[model samples]
Target: MSDTVEGPFFHGTKADLQVGDLLTAGFRSNYRPEIVMNHVYFTALRDGAGLAAELAPGDAAPRVYVVEPTGAFEDDPNVTDRKFPGNPTRSYRSREPLRVVGEVLDWTRLTPEALQGWRDRLAALRAEDRDEIIN
Candidate 1:
């Protein structure tokens, strides 16, 4: 993978955040709460972040925020070459904090049916023990 990526990065979550909030690593994995995350994840694709937001576990509404990495980041190892070749998802992670620069209000939201479909897929993966999260 390349050594650098440019952004206009974004993070998706259900956490309520403000303009100056700093997102950091060492949080629990959204996909697997038993495992703590080592990196703060973000993406260059708005829709990708939106998908993460939708899947994020919470009763609070999903939100996507514009972010700036405070330190070096790299292609997410979980999906970079394992799932698709060469970071087509534009996904990344950082050990350092990511500053919330702004919020993205106009990102596409998934339809209820679409959301259910994704949930079903996740459930199936879990049932089959195929939902391995590399955290």
Candidate 2:
């Protein structure tokens, strides 16, 4: 049987972020939290023709998009405008799921405390599963 493999986790909170959180020089990639941010957004410079096909030909709001918190964002000051340089994906809206934002830490470089926290959650889930089986 295959062993149940847990995973590396993230360590951060809203307190860890700010409205204009800028990435430091040390932050090199979107794969690491210290490298970039967990939350950010980007918009398409031009309306995608694919999305426009669905609508009747007329003047209306363009279907611009923003990337969801797919993973930690890459810090790129060059991507000016509404887009946050931290994430490769663009976010169209302001709100996003916390789970998606948690990918700030690199899987290859997880923090000790973050791993512990993940273990705790996994243990709880396992316990819950056991309780369901016996009851």
Candidate 3:
């Protein structure tokens, strides 16, 4: 993406994710966000719904924050807050430790149709798995 720090993450609203979804969050820094990738589906934990995403590689696990309809919105840790009714603006906070990854190819600029395709692809991956959580 034009503005980003990490990779392999998806960006969207709660409607974009399902229960038992799990995937790495592509971030910018150890402090705030750079770019968000919400096109892919995940094996969601009982973790989040309003823009659900997991921390990157090194942070601890089980850290999540809920961004609801009335929640406050602010600049991403690295950028400014964006207000768009078409876009969800719920704040997500996690306390886990994870390692940040490089951003994907223009993750923030994908068209809705492209995102939908990625969503479908991710869903297909999950469907093929059947056994999601670690055994």
lDDT (Cα atoms) of all candidates against the true structure:
0.90, 0.32, 0.31
lDDT leader? 1
lDDT of 1 by residue, 36-98 (tens): 999999999998999999999999999999999888888998888789778899999889999
TM-score of 3: 0.23
Ranking of all predicted structures according to lDDT, beginning with the best and ending with the worst: 1, 2, 3
TM-score of 2: 0.22
TM-score of 1: 0.90
lDDT, candidate 3, residue 125?
54
In angstroms, give how far residue 93 of model 1 lies from its true place.
Answer: 0.6
Off by over 4 Å in 1: 1-3, 130-135
Candidate 2 — which residues are off by over 4 angstroms? Answer: 1-108
For all predicted structures, in order, the TM-scores are 0.90, 0.22, 0.23
Query: Candidate 2: what lDDT?
Result: 0.32
